[model samples]
Target: MSITPQAQISAQDKSYSAKALVSIALAWAFDAMDFSILTFVLVDIMKDYGVPLTLAAAVSSATTFARLGGGFLGGLIGDSWGRKAGLVISIIWFTIFEFLTGFSIGFTLLFLVRILYGIGMGAMYANGTPMLMEMMPAKWRGFASGLMQSGFSFGYIFAAIIYRVWYGDLGWHAMFYIACIPALVVAIYIWAQVPESSRWRKEKSASKSHSVPVSHLFKDGNTWNTIHAALISLIAFGVTYPINIFYATLLKQHGHFSPAIVANTIIILNVAGIIGNILGGYLSDIIGRRAVLIISAIGTLACSFVFQSISTDWERNLFTFLIGLFSIGGVWAAIPTYIAEHFKTTVRSTGQGTTYHFGAAVGGAIIPLIVSGIAPSVGGLAHAMTYSVAITSILVIVLAVLWRESKGSVLE
Candidate 1:
């Protein structure tokens, strides 16, 4: 049957459910935690497994490259099979590899395992963001999207807690092990608790009667959707990726900080991010997604400069917090929700996931190589970051201006 009349909105669309939002948010948090956990423990893994800093970074980059593929595959699965299927499989798939990475004997084994984990992660974002966005009321789409994206901050904070309590004594393997518990728990929760995307199921059945899938997105006015979302994803992470991924590395190498200081700095950055996620999410509801992007781009550009200037512990803590808040916490408030607006339900996850993960691959995996490669000649990572932020922020603003604002628009 079609969407019930009383519950129907924006034509036949149904109101967003809190249950779906919470389920997707929890799953997204574990995905974020999975990614963040590795970032915190990478240095120790390098020392333990006998690899140089460059190789270790390459291992991380490899996972990102793999994710580009994973995201596309997962998006297809999500759109074709069901969001719940992709959701459960991706969570369990990644967590298993994450647990096994702890037992790896060499860089090759670790690299292969992480590549598989990246695949799972790529799928997670593809499935999770669209799954949640498709279910929400247009009025609360920004709020719902931010709630799902904010899981990254929660995951980062949890990873920091692991580093604070266990990194000194238990080491990198234990950090990977800690991630397994949550992964298993959440995977079970998702299968047992979360419902499939009613929207996808309804549309899928409708289209099958015609035997040809909806072809509107690939042509006409919507042609640039996939490209636009991907570019937006790339720019969002332009500063966010390098800043968070290299937080520990930058503080230790550039600022000459001890391990204790680095851990504290990470925690502070994520704490500020949690607040910014909420603030930006609500503001997008009030102001609009484009405004949130402009505000975030400007904030990230300005804060990145301050972030590069850190020397003292106070400087590191304060600036790290600001960078996290502005670069990701704010931009994330609207990005996934905004991207969801670019496509109808059938291709929503596909468009959002493909571009977003490709962006992640570039931002998370590729950009660091450029910065680190130039670090020796450029004075340090700080100067490289300053230049990157200036350039990326302008690009992000340009995209935000050009991309239509989708605030309060109903999902099709």
Candidate 2:
């Protein structure tokens, strides 16, 4: 049972991969916090700026639309330069804008800063995810993917806490200012501790050209994979945005819940979401990615129905937790790993960024606008969101069934 030198190196790499995961997840959590803090305070922004619901929704949508460009640029930078470089730059870029969001003197300025912030947000995922996937041991990829995605939920919880503590007295601007500090720390940690992806380095050394052409994404029968991935991402974003963006507002204005109740309920939702993310990732590893996705989609649909139908305060809390678990948590856990496996190492970041952000632009951006616009006619925001979730969940189940499974895919 003597361990060979190669075996020893493999063991060391696995150890380093776990460390890298923490650093990346920290960056992801802060990114999520910065993005989600705005949602919790959307109504406050509207009151201060004297904008309509649709206009407030537009600010969120504008950020998502900008992410489309940011994602593309991040992927290109990742593939051309290095994952670390792409990630660090994206983090710094977003941190600056998120800090500036507090300084916005008017609705127009807030909108513009958020749009700029969206690019950095988009880029972080494009760069950080591929790096983690490449570094993680094959056996742990599913769990790692789930944990990484859970950072977003963790961030939402962070946002909720900050909102509850600071929004009433200090105002929304202080929350944004507070977010900048930890994010900068995460950026520094990643730069210092997280090593470049070995797979990316190997690819760079072997390739003649430093950059992979984006055109390659459409060639070699990959166009279908590209289209399918984008459609899946679009569906995920479409279902998610309507609910995540509006749920806080719904609790306050529609349900007439007090601020504490709204914030506490959101915290509960994300806690369940965090559990779902980890469970979904673990299940995907054992059962297969498509099966987990299908299960999550169906579960999400069922939970949304219960969540909408429930009447009592405790019942609402119970079902809201379920909605977060299945819809927000479970469905997203497998996405990064599933999407990353669709492309070769050379084009992985670009493919992921382009497809994910395309979905963000079309599904994430447009669906919120539609929901906000139709809320009055559809009976209310809850009705509109429920309908959107039902339709999109069906799409997710279909797409998961049709999509080729990428489990146990070895990175190039």
Candidate 3:
């Protein structure tokens, strides 16, 4: 039987149940927790292994590379096995590795485990975003996307608080051990709760009747648009993630803030991000996605300069909160929903996952290498961030000019 458009949407509204959102949120929250758990504990890990800071950063880079690979593979798996099942398997895989991460003895072993964990993480985020996006009503897409993305902040805060409590004497191993708990719980929740993406399931059946799989997303007209979107995401993160990671260290080094104060500031940033994400999602739903992006890009660029210049903690906190708010609407929540708009349901997950994770790999891995490689000769972290943010801002303007609005337009 052919699926009516109304019936398809109605089915999605009912099937995407609160249980499903909760499952996706839990998985993503765990994903964020696992990610930040390591960041909080990285110093101890470095001290224990006697590795250089640059080398320690490589572990994160390796995981990012692994996640990219996982995202590509997860698209196929989501197409074949189903989004719900793919999510379950990915969470389980990541959980197992996280459990084992506590036992790792050296940088090599830790890097090896993280690379494996990245595969699962890559698939989870890739599949999770599209799954949640497709399952919701068009009107609520931005809201759902923002709420889902906010899980990262929730996880980061949870990890920070947990680390503070546990890391006092138990050290970094306890943090990794703690990481295993949430993923395990999410794996079970996803297996038992989340429903398969009805859209993907319908498309897969349609493709079987045709005997030819859908073409890869890169071959489409929106392909160029998708590329631009991916580049913007990469450039956005070139500042976002790295800034979150390095800012505390820089404050301690040059701003004369103590480590405790620096840690509190980092937590505040994550908390502010949670608020920003909700506002961004709500605004995109009320205004249009394009409007949200334009506003976000301008705000992020302005905030970057102000954030870099502030020396006092109160000034820094106020600016950081605004920066987090700008980021919430534009870069973080809008990108996945924007990518989802560019392709048909058949290729929606593929386009969204690939561009998002590839951007992540670039932002997480390449940008850091560029900054660090130049840091010795270029003076210091603050100056490097200033230059990077300036370049990224121009790229955002160029990308905005390249993209035509996709909101309220039908996807294939």
Candidate 4:
């Protein structure tokens, strides 16, 4: 029930509302679903592509490379033109390539398809947070941010459902085809329904169509701050990607979990995540972003230890639920809000998007490969996750302590 102390909206701007927030989040949901799809269906991809398990895992990370380029370009386009057009173009580009991914015949061909797919992923994610951050009123920015971040969890939840009903019978490729279609529809709908960002429009009018260079982010007072923030995202990716991206595969192959059990667990975890996202953001509005982040980091650290110590399936499930709560919901709830508060409107989208996505690309693309390589040497996937999570949790705590608190700050 906490609120930001003051709400900032333009005196003449009358079009801002929650509907715009929902539309942006809807676009992002597809990105989350696509990312999660690799986790659930990697085995199928390996079998179909005639590649080894390492290559299969590498493909999961492959999109990250393409995304680096996509994020930069999308941010440039969004900042230069408009958030809406950038998103629509990004969605369409990803949708077509993702559909093409289903038809890839060989490992190289599939990898190439996925690289293109990453572009769309990068573009939308780059644009999504800042667009929402700019449009929503200050009082609700935290909650709005939480909802935007949880768009991925919601997408992950649906992917779990899809795996249950359609994945087994229709197969993974069919799932990709089906998932890509919704993205296209969402793109068209976003094009028709969502308004241009009111903040961006107002600024453009005031400046008479001047453009800001992306390189200027490096020259600002936030130069190091941006790097440190991006490092936080990188560490987030390092901890979460290995454990989450391959969790279902671990359960099914090693832990002897039934597909139903895996699907149900995924659903419950993400549902809890959605709640954590909203609650954590609301709490951050009252307390401070750094405090909520520290709380989240400590919770995640506790979860990691509990995970390593526990052996029973029930206990693992309990810990998994908490991990979803703290790691996915808690940490993510404050990130967009925190990042938005750090930069001016002229460079907000570019600065925030580039740092976040660059970290994501490096972590997403590389960590899975490392995990796949180290899992054998480190005893197993579970052990590898334990160590990675432990290290990243400590880093998060350190960063949280160092990063300045931005509680209840209005967006530029």
Candidate 5:
């Protein structure tokens, strides 16, 4: 077998060696698993709280909105303070809030719990992605970054297993409490295993403890570029997230699958997603970011439409798994690397967090509304997803054409 270009290039550097990457990846993976434990537990939550599915979805949507705020705060602080410190703090915050989520006696309490947890969860992609990028060697950055997110797919799979084992007995409250353990573990591991980004530390030493304002993300020549970039990311994320979270429920309700089967299917799809993130990110590093993205977008457009159309249990599981293979998995792997290459280091985390969260929140808010609204009129979830995916794919292509590669681009 021939050696890949990534392997050839990555052979020279060992900065983010196997152990470092694995530690980082594991922390992030658990973070994802902890955050999404709610998805598996949502049915339990709805039952316990006597809420509607839409309302539970709204709790997630509310978390998306809160993430926007958390991203801004975490980005600003992560830039000024240290990336590792920001992450450790955020993990602790999420842990506390997530544990609190179990104690929620009513909708108001649960909403508050999710909102607080969202604050920490929002900062995750912002800080974690950049921190991993800064620590790793450039030649291997794409793979490392993608691997970091691969944990998310694993985490989703883990959540499924956790639900499979526990959902019958321990209940959602216990699951949320268990979720808190991972957060604490990550926080402790971060304190022990990770170091402050050498790049950020150097900058901090040079700056002599001066604090930067949140507005700096848009100041200087960065304003319009940040806006356009964030908008594109927003569109991508807005379309992907809610759909992934709600997909099992969608199949259960519209397609009439058993809950156990739907959960099992989610695990399978998330497992496929792990491969997609790695494949997409690795390909982008080789083929040029734009080319890989266009392929992913086109694939997403097709698969999403196909996914929405299935009527039988097998068809639903197959199509949904494929959807994760293309859309949810592939898109996430490419996004952070794309953003990191665009802006300077000075504002990389901030810009990335702001733009990504902006996309996430927008997608969270709009897609559900659109999908739910059109589901009945359009005759089903599949048709609605087809229309939504088609439109989003076109827009992604348009945006991809407009945005150029930031490979080897200078950071401030």
Candidate 6:
């Protein structure tokens, strides 16, 4: 029997898909490293710069706040030029700022540099996620989304490892300097290996007009989706930052854990998160995106109570793993696929970027500042986080219930 031309093309496509996933996932991992490195060293920065916890926490807030604009600009670039261009530009932009972060002589300088770095971090997600989703086959998109999102865990784990091994010897500045090198390599790899999204190209060719105004997202029937998606994103980021940004501080200040213990615990959390990411993604494919999201939210809420009440070291570790699995891992895995499917290809990047980062601004930026400010009066970081998580998790459940499922929906 002779081989079919269709089969040959299918084989070629699978090969390209594999390459794209690897390349994009690598970039995501490095991006994670850069963003998260600050969390690990935040306490140290406070002592070194003679700043209060609230001021130091503001550094992270500034970065996340800037992500809102970066995400919007990145989506516009992706929509207007090409996904690949937006991605490459974002990678380069972040890498440069991350490296420059090493040179900051004061807290103000560090805060400003990080805000710039945050923009690049936001742009990377805006461009890379849509590109990956468009390249994947419908049946596999859930798993692929899960796998891509897991790069965040991988990056967190890498940052943990770097902090553990190098921080004592070389200090935090070296950590920022080291993170930029491999990220640049990933950018070059993406530039050379990853092709532009075929769906974006097709949409561009088929449309009568070249330019789609940003107003289109809020016009017609899209207004509700645009609003709902951003709301969900806001809740997601709001719930997540309380746990993620402050976990180390909680363990160190409240629990009085050693540096080694803190790093190891974080590693455990991220490992569980990685597993949750894959599980959530796979389950979303099997059940539905909405269902998985609801499950994650409910699970996170239950676990937060358990995590907060626990006393023993062993119990703390166990619940930490659970929090990572349910909250950090599962909820995020389904987000990219769910949100990207909300808009047509012509406006998909813009919709995904703007809505997602808008959430980050309120949830990620403002929430942390609130947490830091209220910690002393509220009982400390742990209690403030518990209250925040409970409220946000409830909101997520409400939002997830309201959202229509997008699993297996064909992209335009």
Which stretches of candidate 3 lie above 4 Å from their native place?
1-15, 209-215, 220-222, 252-259, 305-311
Give me candidate 2's TM-score against the actual structure: 0.97
Model 5: lDDT equals 0.74
**240-332: candidate 2 lDDT, tens digit per residue:** 888778888888887788889889888888898899999999988988889888888898898776436535877888888888898888888
Q: Return the top candidate by lDDT.
A: 2
For all candidates in order, the CA lDDT equals 0.79, 0.89, 0.73, 0.79, 0.74, 0.88
Q: Give per-residue CA lDDT, model 6, range 281-333, as digits (tens).
A: 99989999988888888888888854364358788888889888988888888
Clash pairs for candidate 2: none
Sorting all predicted structures by lDDT, with the top scorer first, yields 2, 6, 4, 1, 5, 3
Off by over 4 Å in 2: 1-4, 306-311
Q: Which ten residues in a row have the lowest lDDT in candidate 1?
A: 7-16
Candidate 2 minimal-lDDT segment of 10 residues: 303-312
> How many angstroms is residue 320 displaced in model 3 relative to the true structure, after the best TM-score fit?
2.0
What does candidate 1's lDDT look like per residue over 122-154, in tens digits?
A: 888888888887777778888888777888888
TM-score of 1: 0.92
Runs with alpha carbons beyond 4 Å of true place in candidate 4: 1-15, 305-311
Task: Compute each candidate's TM-score over C-alphas.
Answer: 0.92, 0.97, 0.90, 0.93, 0.90, 0.97
Query: Model 6: how large is the Cα RMSD against the reference?
Result: 1.3
- Across 50-151, the per-residue lDDT of candidate 3 in tens digits comes to 986677777877887788888878766776677787788888888888888888998799999999999988888767877887777777777777778788
lDDT of 4 by residue, 353-390 (tens): 78888778877667767777898999987777777777
Clashes of 4: 0
Could you give me the TM-score of model 6 versus the true structure?
A: 0.97
- The alpha-carbon lDDT assigned to residue 209 of candidate 2 equals 93
